[model samples]
Target: MAVAQPKIDLAESLLSRHAAPGPGARWAQEARAAAAARLRAMGAPVRRDEYWKYTDPARLTAAELAPAAPLEPEKEALYGDRAQLKLVFVDGVLDADASDALALDGLTVEPLARALATDIHWARDLYGVLEARGQDPVPRPLAALNTAVAGQGVAIRVSARVATPVTIVNRQRAADSDVVLHHLILLEDGAEMTLLEAGPAGARYNTCLEVDLGRGAQFHHVRTQGRDNERHAITHSFARLAAEASFKAFTLTVNGVLTRNESVIEFTGDDAKAHVAGAAAGDGRFHHDDTVFVTHDGVNCESRQVFKKVLRNGALGVFQGKILVRPGAQQTDGYQISQALLLDEDSQFLAKPELEIYADDVACSHGSTVGAIDEDAMFYLTSRGVSKPDAQDMLVLAFLDEAIQEIEDDALADGMRERLAGWLARRR
Candidate 1:
């Protein structure tokens, strides 16, 4: 199909700023070229698009980034006390001085730039493979653009069950910085690894992560989007699970002017499990969106999606999730829930939860709800001599705990709980 002139112009304008990677392997060159073509064909998202109707894409796709002053650092960074290998990026560039050594036992870690430069490497087969597969049934032009141009991120290959986690830290130093990052992760059979991501990447940030899990492999991920009131970001996560493999991811978002996160999961092997959950809190002038697509192609597979949001003072939240069970995917169990608590009359939540099952034996369900805080619960607490603000904060925490409980790691879950409590306390 021929692309519209305006779409071609927009794609070209973004591509003009980023040249194809220099002196790379043949496969890498081809992947970038193919991604560029895909982006031009699909075009940048607009409000008229079916998937983008709830949120505007103008700020994200604009020619220039809107300036966002960095926020003051918290007394302690998220997961700072945990023992892990750290990779730090300042204003979208890797900061060696602030990062730990890349060397780790039972794992091969290298910068994405170097990985793409190598003629022969395992990443060659996985870098853009999953992201390309995720494009089908839905068009993700931004992810395609990132695959074509992003040069700063990590490439990790896990060979065994690593005791420690790998953490990626992003920090913004410039008010007008625009960051594009792409990460590739591959887990071998019987391997296990955990990944942690935190911080506000840039004033305008675009990132994509592609993960592939072999048979019996397990991958756990937890992330916290930093508090930067004026920041704008769009992120994509794509994962493929093999037989008996497990994939779980949880995210906590507190503040941002405009934020959208998309996750695409494909199950290719039987007896696999995948869960994706998120909790978000927003105040005035805030907009948060979570979009997820999970496909089950293997028999006896399981998938879950849980998302919760708290909005107040005209903040808006959006959730769009779908579960697709193929013809041969019998005994597939899928569940999805998206709910929001509106503190005032002005706040709003929009949800679209869908389930499509071609297999007659599959069990799939989805639900979405929006409402205010429970007045009965509030009255009970207030009658017990608890302060109104304190009672409200407690109820708010309870409302968000369901999503937070999806995290497998107790310590990480505790950290997230504390962060949510602090955010609520500050408002009180």
Candidate 2:
């Protein structure tokens, strides 16, 4: 007879030891335990999983990072020279001493644990609803691990008719530790808010954000990730839009050992619209991937996705986008485009844009292109006496400029452009 292998009761073990139950940590413990059970039942994802085939989660997640250690003086310098509303979280705890941005009138920025401690309704409503829509059989191990030990994160809510924007800055200190999951929740109805996110940590960090938009609500979310070469970062953002609500997002990834970002938006009511765009620059041995899923469950919803990538050396780039139209989603207009220019043959990219529609009246389209630097354009510029490196950088900026300009904040857009040029110059 074959020997019996030991089975691990992960849920019970985590609940008994790692569960941080407190005033603000209300249902977190229970939800975490439940998620642990789900993960245990499903096991870790392998090469066979469809969504995870290209990127191997087994090697990346073989060891769980501990809570981040305290920040050193040099690590603190990472957050320097950025103008935005800042919310600093050290380790798994929010750093109240480092923030100076006061909450504006009609706006609330509090700790997620605090909100649940006083009243747990909001936390309960948002955490587990979206898991039902995606029919994938495998349990998300990363998500489960995140929920299991999610310490304190930030939360912001805008009252009706409020127009002020809130910026949340997340920083990680350098220290060998288990993974840190940053959970953020944003709520707006008849209100307009913008989130300017800054992450300049040189440590391993994992972040998760969930946003809910009520009727007529508008949001502008911008995220910047600039870390050192040793850090590994993963971020997931989920949004639910009501009737006529508008959602806009811009993401910038500059430096990291491995960085992956996932954005999923659901049109829960009719007439909702979403605009998403991002720019990523990676060089050397770095790897970056941006995956998105836009689902239309109601009638007359609109969505547009545009992603640009600048890769050099032996770096790898991946972009996967899917647009799904449910059975009764009539009059849906969905468009997606992913384009990348490889600076050399060693650099690589993988782009897959997919569409699934059940309604005959819907219009959905997707296109992807990967090519070398345009020689014609290079010649046109060089004929004017521009250097080879300068010409290549110009074409790259022009290619990515379309999406960068979509950002309404002039200051942020210009800052991103300047940084993009700088990165290209350094690589050259």
Candidate 3:
């Protein structure tokens, strides 16, 4: 069926026009041009779009960027690990002088701009390939816009085991900053690495990360969006896994006015395993949403998704997730669950979980739930001399711990626990 004429007109009116790629490698420029064309054909975000019907899309499509005050540098880092290599971005501009050298055994990390300057590079083939492949089932126009005019990011190619994990740190120092970045991650056969990201790029930002996993590769990603009260953000992650590849990713979002994160994953080869999970907390006019799609096209692949949210004082949370099993994809194992704890009657949690299977022998299941904090547990803790607020905090931690345990690394899980505990402490 053809899209109505009014839909095209609305998309054109709401879509922001980004600047063209300048003097980059021929391949990058050509790719950007193609992406821009696709964005135009797709149109802008409208209420008619089923994927965005619950959330308002006007702010995302607005032409002007929002103003976000720079947050004071924290004396104690959120992650509290100084040994890891830190790639810093200030106001959306990559800071090369202050960052750790882009050198690691079996990995090549280059600035997107620099990669575009070279005559030939593997990034040329992956810059926007996986993102385009994820357009089906739903069209992500904001992601397409990021691809068309992403000015700063990194391209990482990993071919062997890396001894150290790399963290991407984004810092916003200026108000009304418009930040656009796209990162390409390519893992060769038998490669392994851990990728971490944190911070708010700008008041309004569009960020995209595309991951391509070769046979037998292993990749892990853990990210913290930010604690900025005035910030609004929309981000997307697209990943493709090959045979025997393993991918695990988790995100923590706290204290943003509005945040919508979309994740798309596809298993193209048999025997691959993937896990995606997130934990979010919001209060006082906060709104958070996570939309995810996992596709299984190969036999014997496995996938799991776990999400938890805490809301209070009229705050809102949303989760829309789906797992798809294609024809001939036998022995697929998929599981998904999303839950929320509401501290007050005014708060709300919206969830939609789905499973689509063509093969009769596969096992796929999903569940979603929203409920108030466990009063019995809260009373049990309060009876032990804990204050009401402190008891509530403990219960909230216990509720979210299930999702945090999804991280296999002990240190990483410890870091997540500390951050969540700190946030809860402040609120109490």
Scored by TM-score, the top model is: 1
TM-score of each: 0.98, 0.88, 0.96
**Tens digit of per-residue lDDT, candidate 2, span 1-428:** 22112213433343344446354445655665676665556554555556676665543454454333444335322323544456776544567888756566777777766765654456666653443233243235555555555666766777755545555555556575334454555566677777777654325655667778888788888777754555576777778888899989998877676777878889999998998898988787777888888999888999989888888888888888989898999999999989888888898898878898989899998899898889999999999999998998999999898779778878778888887787778777
Better of 1 and 3 by TM-score: 1
- Give the clashing pairs for model 2: 65-177, 65-178, 65-179, 66-177, 66-178
lDDT of each: 0.91, 0.70, 0.85
Per-residue CA lDDT of candidate 3, range 1-428, in tens?
66667656655554445555567888888887778777778876676788887777777777665677778768213566546778898878899997999988889998988887677999887888888888887888878778888868999999998757889988888877777888889999989888988988877888999999999999999999767777788889999999999999999888888899999999999999999999999988888889999999999999999999999989899898999999998999999999999999999998989899999889998899998988888788888999998888888888898889988888988898889898989887
List CA RMSD, all candidates: 1.2, 3.9, 1.7
lDDT by residue (328-365, candidate 1, tens digit) is: 99999999999999999999999989888899999898
lDDT of 3 at 415: 91
Assess the local accuracy of residue 234 in candidate 3 as a C-alpha lDDT between 0 and 100. Answer: 88
